[model samples]
Target: MISDSMAEVLRLLQLDDGFDAAAEVAVRAAETLGVDGLTVSLATGGEQAELVWCTDEAAGQFEDLQFTLGEGPGPDAVRAGAMVLVPDLAQVRAGRWPALTTESGALAVCAVFCFPMAIGAIRVGVLTVVRRTVGPLTDAQIGDAQVLAHALTGRALGATVLDQDKAPLLHAVVHQATGMVSVQLDLPLPQALLRLRAHAYSSGRPLLDISRDVVARRLRLDLNGNGDGNPLPVSDKD
Candidate 1:
C-alpha cells in the first residue's frame, strides 16, 4: 500500500515538470514529516557540498552554519553514508560538535535529521530536515523521509547533469572567497577556509556575510591580532 506521504511524492514527481522538481518533492516531504523546513545539498568535487535548495530561512541558516563549522548531523551523514537523526541538539555531547552545538543555539533549531542520498558506495548528496521542537520523528515520518531520500538520489543524478547551471550554487561565493583568502594569507584552501570560519564565529557574524566582505575587498584579513587575540583582523581595504 502506498503511504499518503509517498503517494504525494509520486504525484508530485509525475505532475511537477518545473525545473526544481526535486525541491518540490522535498518540500512536500518536509510537510509530511512535520518539520519546520529542510535543505538539500549535492556533493561537489572533493569535500565540497553545494547548497542546491532550501525550504525556509531557518533551514538555510542551519545549513550554512554546518558548512562554516564543518560539523553537525548533515556532515556526519555524508561522511558516514548513513542517516544521522538528532532528536534534541541539547542532548548531544559537547565534544560531538562543540562549535556547532554552541553556535546553533542562537538559531530557532532544536532538532535536525539528516538523510544521506546515496546508492551503494556512491554518495549523491544529503537531505537535512530541521525543526524548532525537540523530539524524535515518529516511525511513519522516518519511513516517509527514507522514501524521499531514495527518490532524491535518482532525481539528483539527473539534475546534477541537466540542471547544473539552473540549480543555485549558494556556496560559490564562499569558495571564491576561500581562494582569495588562500592567496592573501599564502595558505592552502583548507587553512584559508578555517580562518574564514574562525573570523565569522569570533565576530558572531554569518560565514556567508564574511565571505561576501572578502570577495568585495571591503574586508581584508591580516595577521595582526584583534583585541580578542584572533590573528585574523577585519579591516576595510584602502
Candidate 2:
C-alpha cells in the first residue's frame, strides 16, 4: 500500500491538474497509519499556521478545533518541530489544552499524532493523524508517517520534482486567497492570510475548500468576516 500510494502520488503529479496533491498524500498516509482522519498544516517562523488540506469532515473538524481555540497537537508539534503523540486524549493532563481535549472528545477522536513537516532548519507544516480509539502508533506506522511527511514537504514547498506549472498551483490558490482576503479586510496581505486561516477553522472547512471558493467568487468574506457572495477582485500579482 505504501509503494502504491507513492506511485499514485507521482502519477497524479504528472496527469492531474488543479488537484490537492498534498491532501492526497495525507489521505494515503492516514490509511497506512490506520487513522480515521488526517490533515496538513503549513507554518513559517513557527508562530502562525495555515491548513493545507484535510481528508474528511472529521479531519477538518480536528484542525478547526485546534485553530479556532488556538491550541492543540498540531500547534505543539509545529512549535517543537517534533512529533506530538497523544495515545489517548482522555488521559491528558488538564490545562494543557482544556478546550482542545473537550472538543476532541465531542468529535470522537481518541488518539492523535502530529508530525512536523520540516527539513533541517526549514519548517513547512505538520501532518496530523486522528484515530477514534486510543493507542500509540506501531513503530512501523510511525516510520510510514515519517516517510510520507518527507515527500509531502517537498511537494508543499513546490520543489522541482513536479512539473513547473503543476508545482505552484498548490501554493498559488493560497496566495490568491490571501490577496482577496487582504482586500476584503483592507489589511496587509500577511494579516489577511492569518484571517483566512482563522475563517477556515471557524467554518469547519478545509483551507483549500474555502480558498477555492474565495478564488472562484463563490464565497466572499466581508469586512465583518461573515460569508458574502459579492465577487471581489483577486490579482495574480498578490
Candidate 3:
C-alpha cells in the first residue's frame, strides 16, 4: 500500500505543471505517513533558503520559526546532507537547537523528521515533516518519505528551469537580491546573503519579502546598518 501511494506521488509530480502539484505531494505524504504537516525548503545561497511549499498553516509556522531563528532540523539536515529525525523534540539535549525545541513545543509538535534534498554534491534543501504525537516514523513511513523527497527534489529543481532562462534550481529573485546586496555593500556574495538573512530574521519578515523589496528597488541595505526605502549612492568600490 505504501509503495502504491509513493508511486502515485511520483506520477502526480511528473504531471505537475506548477508548484501546486509539488505542494500536493507534500500534503499526500503527510496523509500517507500519518504526520500532521510537512514543508519543503530550498537553499538559495549560503545559509539562506526559501520555503517552496508546505502542507498546511502549521507546517508554514514550523518552517518560519526555523527560518527566523536560524536553527532547526531542516537546516541541520541540509547541512549534514542527511536525515535528522527527532522522534521527541522535547527530549533533545540541552543547547541542541534550544530555540526550535522551545518554540515548537508551544505548537504541540512532538516529532520532526527531516530529509535532505540533494543531487550529487549539490544540496538543494530539506523536506521536514512534523507530528503532534510522540513517536518515530515506522520503517515503512521513512521509506515513503524518502520516495516523496525524491519527487519533491525533482519538482523544485525543475521549477527553476521551467520558469525562465535555466538557473540553478533555486529562487532567482532571492539570488538577484543577493547580488544587489553584494554590489551595494561591496561585500562578497556569501557575506551579503548572510547579512540579508540576519536582517530578515531580526525584523521578523519573510526572507522572500525582503528579497523582493531589494529586487524591486523599494529597499536598500546599508553597510552602516540600515535597511530603508531610500537608496544609498552605489559604493565607490561597486
Among these predictions, the greatest TM-score belongs to 3
lDDT of 3 by residue, 107-136 (tens): 867888999886444567788898888899
Which candidate do you rate higher for TM-score, 1 or 3? 3
* TM-scores for the candidates: 0.63, 0.59, 0.64
lDDT of 2 by residue, 157-183 (tens): 544342332333366686788788778
Per-candidate clash tally: 0, 0, 0
Misplaced by over 4 Å in model 1 are 17-24, 159-238
The regions of model 3 sitting more than 4 angstroms off are: 159-238
| Clashing pairs for predicted structure model 2, backbone only | none
Reference-based lDDT, residue 160, model 3: 22
**lDDT per residue, candidate 1, 1-238, as tens digits?**
3378777775676565542646777677678889999898887755678887788898889998997788889888988889999999999976999999888889999899999986444577888999999999988888778767766665654432222322222567777887898799776554566677668767877778888888989898875643233646677675
Ranking by TM-score: 3, 1, 2
Sort every candidate by lDDT, greatest first.
Answer: 1, 3, 2
